[model samples]
Target: MAAQQPSEKILVVDAQADSAKLIVLQLQEAGFAAVWARDGEAAIGMLDGDDYSLALLDIRLPKANGIEVLSHIRESGKDTAAIMMTAHGNENLAVECMKAGCVDYLSKPFAMDDMLQRVMRAMTNRRVLLQKQRLEQEKDDFVSMLSHDMKNPLTAVIGSIDIIREGRLGTVNQEQAEYLHAAIDSCNEVIAMIDNLLDIHRFEAGRMQMKIAAYSAVEILRGGTRRFTRIAEHDGIRLRERLSHETPRIAVDKNAFSRVIANLLANSVKFTPEGGEIVVSCRCLKGAEVPWTRLPSYVTVPDGFAEKDCFVQVSIRDTGSGIPPDDLGRIFERYVQSRSGVGRERGGAGLGLAFCKMAVESCGGIIWVESEAGLGSIFVILLPCYLNGTECTGK
Candidate 1:
């Protein structure tokens, strides 16, 4: 049961002045502040000017009806709960009012005790709704605070590991160097996890602002893929890229674009086994060639872009264990991971792909994946080409 508020208010709207007075007297005696309205129009005017926890609306009223007032309240997004007061034969009308968002209804000639009980119940439900909203807000604030506090210490640890791996303090033997390198890698992984946590919070809170500008798609893809070459080679995997010179520049947040590419490459590297090959490729595509329906829900196109606009497509294809059909649909959701054993073995907090999806979508692009179990996966990113007055022909 929801908690009760002692200062709750109720509005009583009745065409009969006597009925309205009696109802208001009963509500006031029940410890609720009661206000009276002679008809539906007056009730609506009062509702617009004041905040009432519940409204007791009579079906029969002068000038306007209870149902019409209820519709206006709903359309205005008021949080007030409502109960309809109907005559004995108006059961059908009461049902219709309930369907139109009335919380409860009382028949005419109802006992004062029953009226008070219904009022209390409606107020309690409203209290519960407000409480739930407050709790959700608190939870988001707590997560933001925790993620921010974790970054400072993790940054210092990453810096120390970098120093040791680079031999800034002294010379080190081959075995020692290998151990240091592993330590550095582990530290970097922790830092990445911390960054993902922060980014997810910012994305959900709408605080992740993007610095949009025109940038070469080729340069972004090449630079992003180049960072992972040493890691791929170390794992005995072949990494290559194929870029089309005809690809146009894309308007996006440079840092966010880089992070999106990094996350995709990291995901591919984690799943691809030894002797596997991963290819990063880019090309131009006409809007007709793009499959909008197949795109994940996190991806959204900008409003002005249409089916005739030109786009640049970047694909990362890997020879790795692909996702199971069931998990593929939810792969980009926050904190969701594949149920496959591979996901369990390759541990993550499952925010990498989610971040990539949000970052790409923030730039008015789409990200999607195509995969079959044991046949490897292909991840694609489609971004709007910067046309700049020249007609884009997907050259």
Candidate 2:
């Protein structure tokens, strides 16, 4: 640990010259690269100038004060850790600093050895946090690239299969048509899985790019159902659409939006038994009409969505074995596995919903679910309606 400390630079912010110098020297001697700042303001400047592993801050300072400085770090969302030190050490103030995201707190005139241990702990914490973030980023990148690469060839194969099925190459018999349909279905299932993984990774990493364009909500919904029609029928299930007479255009990434629709429909088709019915419906929703209270926390609706005037709401209601009541709240979370029929037994426990939630939120939309144990489920989405690249206000 001592040998590794040289890589971690620490900031010591104390008004008292003697105390600050002593602390900096101790850290330097212990193999860390320590810098001294005479006040909170100077600490802030140092923070901005270079990457610091941790900050040893004094609660009382000439400018800005320790709490204010820490607040700045947090508000800036920098990857820096802080440990508050104060001459007037009170239990309440320590608790307050801790709550303010300090790694540790120390009183003036404290033992030098004790302070070093605290510094080491804070450094360790920072190291762990940074390592975790790096691992998560790597995982996300791996999945994103994997899925993107797999999708292209799979798509080409599907297109070629479609051409053959349509007799573009030659005449096709009924049996051959059945075989081609099976092949298409298998390829589509793979595609949907790949899309789910890719989108979920991109969304989680905040790297998802959307090419927002307006399209008829009804048409988008209908197009989503086309691929699933044969699969549902083959499973003895009915797949249909229920679009309103007055459907509005929705601004979204057409491909991602269609993928969202496909994900929900696929889920419905997977669990819904033979003879079950799946209805894809589209309607308009006022911003105030969204049941915000019932919308689960797992759905990541972006800021200001609640204030939109008009939205295009699409709901995929299925007569499948409904989600377990306890799982509804977490169904949209990544990797969530419900205990009921929607559990890991059938695969894709929580990934599809995560992708759906993120996709909707990317368009400044909201997505949620409603269901009981045996009453089937309805996955509802509300994407803000836009006219010419701007959100539509209710007329």
Q: What Cα-based lDDT does every candidate model obtain?
A: 0.84, 0.84
lDDT of 1 at 256: 86
Clashing pairs in 1: none
Alpha-carbon runs more than 4 Å astray in model 1: 1-21, 28-118, 197-208, 287-306, 389-395
State, as a TM-score between 0 and 1, how close model 2 is to the true structure.
0.71
- Per-residue C-alpha lDDT of model 2 across residues 212-288, encoded as one tens digit per residue: 88888888888888878988998899998899958778888899888888888988987788889999998888877
Model 1 lDDT per residue over 1-395, tens place: 24335568888999898878998887777777898999888988999999888889998888889999899889989889999999999999999999999999999889988888888878878889889989978977777665667666766877887787678888777878777776766666666777777787888878888898888889998997888897788778999999998888888899989888988998898888899999999998888888776766545566756554688999999998899988887989888887756536767888889998888888878788899988899999888788663445454
Candidate 2, superposed: residue stretches over 4 Å from native: 1-110, 156-173, 285-311, 342-346, 383-395
